[model samples]
Target: MTANTGFLERTFKLSERKTDPKTEFLAGLTTFMTMSYILAVNPNMLAEAGMDRGGVFTGTILASIIAMLIMGFFANLPFALSAGMGLNAFFTYTVVLTMGHPWSYALTAVFLEGIIFIILSFFKVREKIFFAIPTSLKNAVSVGIGLFITLIGLTSSGLIVANDATFLSLGELTSRTSVVAIFSLILMAILTAKNVKGALLYGIIAGTVLALILGVTSLPQGTVFSLPPSISEVAFKLHWDNIFTLDMFSVMFTFLFVDLFDTVGTLTGVATKANLIEEDGNLPGVGRALLADAIGTVSGALLGTSTVTTFVESASGVAEGGRTGLTALSCAFFFFISLFLFPLFSIIPAQATSAALIMVGLFMITPITNIDLEDFTESVPAFLTMVTMPFAYSIAEGISVGMITYVVMKLCTGKHKEVSPIMYVLAIIFAIRYLRPILPF
Candidate 1:
């Protein structure tokens, strides 16, 4: 091996994980393709909250690059971090627009949440919570995230649409987007069945080509590369005027709560799918991963975005044979390059990536067989964890519901000994969080 190759092997332990540079690079590319939609989506969403669109765009990329690099170099995990989808919506719709807080004020809340996360991670509080989770719940989290990802794919490809009457209904199968996504899914399935490498990546490329041919998407009209926009308007713009108020606490708590469990769920689910979890049900280097995620959130808020957490799309990489931080390093490198090639990356239609997400979802759900079905106590919470994710459209909510139900089931069945102390505390905390909306206080 060359000196550069040897250095990389020592840094990321590529051989130790049974993944070569080629496979890791391909996995990272697949992951980036599946999640590159955030480049457009995050800026657009945050702009609604009165933040500068260009600044938010730049901030999003920078934060992702930094966090992903940390994940690669520090955590040695394959996960990619970025501005979270649901948390961004809350920052825009619920925090600023609904609560009437200034955009700067909202950013402050996010910053505070990150600080708290860092402290928790430093103390290994997050790690303890992770280890405390039951193996059944962990498997269920993987299954739940699978369904959630598939739901996102279906919606993004226009195969699923919101219905005014029944909540969700199927879209026209003949539509260009849905047709392309379906074709890509089939192609990927064939490739996967044949044990082909980079199946998801090939499927996304094929789908994008088909989308262009069918006029569902178009190539960029001008030069594909350009300088990124300035973040002067949004970077370091947090406000402290409302920091001491009850409203601020509520907003920050919401950010912390969602980000905390969301990161936990993503780590649990994706790590499980990657087979990184040990026989004892703990993931090695997870504390470092949580610290990386916390740093991402803090840096994201400073740079003008919402919470930055691990993307479920990283599962696409794991599904493609990624097993080390080299995959994350590849993603970080591509994110840096994207600053100049945003237009090129943007041309990849959502329908293309949707197929990859759906395929990754299939890979993630395989752990369901590990859950004990004969035992009602274990099966009930596990089943709830699997179904609630897609139904509630929130990974954290699925985990919260699962934990609460798991605790209650164990306690009522005279099996409380099976529940860990941390699990009990977490259940009570989640219960109070849910009840806060109904509480008079």
Candidate 2:
């Protein structure tokens, strides 16, 4: 081998992993294709919260590139990081819009969440928390987030609209935006059924084209490739004035909770697919991987975005024979190149991105099958968690109610042994939070 090839092989331990450079590169490319829809979706979501669209676009790319590199070189794992979808939804819809906090305040919460995550990872406290939450509630969180995201997509696409009578009703199905979104959703389903790579990306492109044809959106006036927009408008804009408020603490904790479970779930699920789980039922080098995720969230907040976490789409790379950090390295390179393609990504209208959000929601809800429906003790809390998120329009609320119910159900049924100490503390905390409004503090 040439010197460069020899060095890469030694660094990534390609021989020990039983893989080569070509296979790793191919797997990375496949992974990028599947998840690159984030390039179009994230900026649009953040823009709704009054952020600079161009700046968020640039920040998203930079944060993703840096995080993936860390995952490659430091963690030496085939995982990719990006601004998480459900977390971003909470950032935009719940924190900014619903709660009336400024975007900078939300950024501060994310930054704090990252710092705490780093400390927890170092102490191995994150794993303890992970195992403390019941499996049914864990699965319910995913399902709830999925429904919440789908609601966002439907409203954004004008497929569903607010009504004074029934609260929410269908929009004009004949409208151009709704038509394109429906078409894209159908196309994505067909492509996914056919086992097509990059199905969501393809759906977004087709939706954009249909929108252009229908005059729902217009084409960009400039070159497809250009210098990335300046991130000065959004970068490092954390607001500290409200940092000590109870609301801020709750928001930060929610960000911490969601990101913690999401990262652990993605890592464990994908690592299992790659057969990286050891005989002791633990993943080797997971601390480094969690550290990489923590650092990514911190950097992403500083760079102006939502909490960053490991993407489940990395399973695409693992499925394609990626077993080492080389795959992550290759995927990072693609994100670097995409920085200059802002014009193309910017022109992808909300209707097109709505399709991707809805499809992602569908993917996230698959864990619902794992929840045991026969046991009301387990199923009640899980069902409440699944329904509360979309109905209440809050991810944090779903988690709070679920925990409170789970602890109550177990205690009342004389199954209190199943509830961990950590869980009891969380349930008490959430209960007090709910009662705070009436307590005249």
Identify the candidate with maximal TM-score.
1
lDDT of 2 by residue, 1-441 (tens): 899889988788888888888878877875676577788888899999999988998898888888888899887899988999889999999999999999999999999999999899889887665556687777787777678768878998899999999999999999888999999889988987887756676787798899989998776786888888899999999999968999999999889877876687567556655667565446667888898899899999999999989987776576567889999988888888889875665566778767766776776677678779999899999999889888987666777788899999999999999899999998998898789889877
lDDT of prediction 1: 0.94
Candidate 1, residues 95-120, lDDT tens digits: the string is: 89999999999899999999999999
Runs of candidate 2 with Cα error greater than 4 angstroms are 1-56, 72-113, 231-289, 304-334
Model 2, position 54, has a per-residue lDDT of 85
lDDT of 1 at 131: 97
Model 1's TM-score against the true structure: 0.98
**Model 1 residue 324 lDDT?**
93
True lDDT of residue 413, candidate 2: 99
Candidate 2 structure, TM-score to reference: 0.74
The parts of candidate 1 lying over 4 Å away from their true place are 437-441
